[model samples]
Target: MDNRNMSDIIESYLKEILDQKNQIEIRRSEMADLFNCVPSQINYVINTRFTIHKGYKVESKRGGGGYIRILKINLLTSNDYLETMSEVIESDLTESEAHAILEQLYGNNLISAREFRLLVTIFDTKNLSTCEDLNKLRSQMMMGLLERLAYEELE
Candidate 1:
């Protein structure tokens, strides 16, 4: 709707499709009819936008029940995931939320029992029982610890 070129539109659509992990099966004639362009225009857009170099695989059938299938390549770099998790935990977390995140890290084999115990020691509320206003402080500290670990993992 913003007057983007055909390739941009196709690229955006492909991203959405990949996010949903749903295969696209558009008939060439139907696509051409919807876009009010020749079928070759659709071919050009598909070739340019859904290429393997851009992390996609495409297949097409040519008969009466023919359709196009696009598969997205999932690239999960460890450093990237770690960096992203570090950025995600920059905000405060509730105790239960922090425990859940810690569980996830444990389940993913990202941290050992000693590290988990250390984190629990660092975030335990027993040490702060003397303070009357430490409700969210534990959560903040836990988030800070996780963020630091994630950042360290990126290095």
Candidate 2:
């Protein structure tokens, strides 16, 4: 029931797709041979993990020349948005600066309305203690969070 290996395989395959600029064409048989698994294993991984919920687009063909294409989904203008987010996190950001960045994502339709609200609420100034060093902590935390978001597990 754990299916850890299955999950790991799926994650690794997803990473390969992402690393190759979100474009890949591999035959099911070739992939199965490489993984030392059956073709259905490949199909199962694709069906479960490469879903839109996780921000990917998948297409496939059937016949003598069948292939699969996996595209990484970006919420439009994502590159520019990520660059700006990196800048804001790198520099000294006041409460207004943080708020503005979140607002921009909300306005651009990058983040859902609920997610935007939750993010704003979690990073609220009211939650921090007077003696706690918020600026330094926020900068460190932001970088770590960004790294986690940016890096994907390899297949």
Candidate 3:
């Protein structure tokens, strides 16, 4: 009895392929046929799951012989990735946004699993519910962590 939704299953299936390679190319119709789903369902999965902020680059070829290409992006230097992410972190952070940022860091190997879990705990909305200005506090805390990470990269 798997409670996972179709999108989760589809995303997991695609990620398994991505783990073996930096990129994957597949036909949309073929994917739908394999999964016993509609092409639009495939589109929805790709559109939401394979997003840029999630550190994925997606390109598609249209018309006959069309296919989708998903690439897991990598940076030559970790600092460059951190700098880009620093800019991406919003002034008022939401829990989902923080989770995405943390996941990106963990996925890129910039943060260890322990650090990721700790950060996730700290940034969880429930933990910050008592704060008067939760977003502001979370933003400042994340900025501090980002600065610490950047500084550690110098050593």
Best by TM-score: 3
Candidate with the larger lDDT of 1 and 3:
3
Error of 2 at 1 (Å): 20
Local error of candidate 1 at 19, Å? Answer: 1.8
* lDDT tens digits by residue: candidate 2, 17-87: 68768566778899888888888988888776665434556899999999988876555555545554665
Score each candidate by Cα lDDT. 0.63, 0.65, 0.86
**lDDT (tens digit, per residue) of candidate 3 on 55-113:** 77799989898889999877778787778767866778777767877898898788999
TM-score of 1: 0.44
Minimum summed lDDT over a 10-residue window in model 1 is located at 73-82
**lDDT at position 95, candidate 2:** 54
TM-score of each: 0.44, 0.47, 0.73
Query: Which 10-residue window of candidate 2 scores lowest in summed lDDT?
Result: 146-155
Model 3 TM-score, 2 decimals = 0.73
User: Which RMSD values do the candidates have, in order?
Assistant: 14.6, 14.2, 3.1
Candidate of highest lDDT: 3
1 or 2, greater by lDDT: 2
- Superpose all Cα atoms of candidate 1 onto the true structure and report the RMSD in Å to 1 decimal: 14.6
Clashes, model 3: 0
Per-residue C-alpha lDDT of model 1 across residues 1-155, encoded as one tens digit per residue = 59997667666765786789845667778877877778888888888666543345689999999988787644364344344444555345445545555654554556788887776565556766785555467656755655676677767
Each prediction's total of clashing residue pairs, residues at least 3 apart in sequence or on different chains, is 0, 2, 0
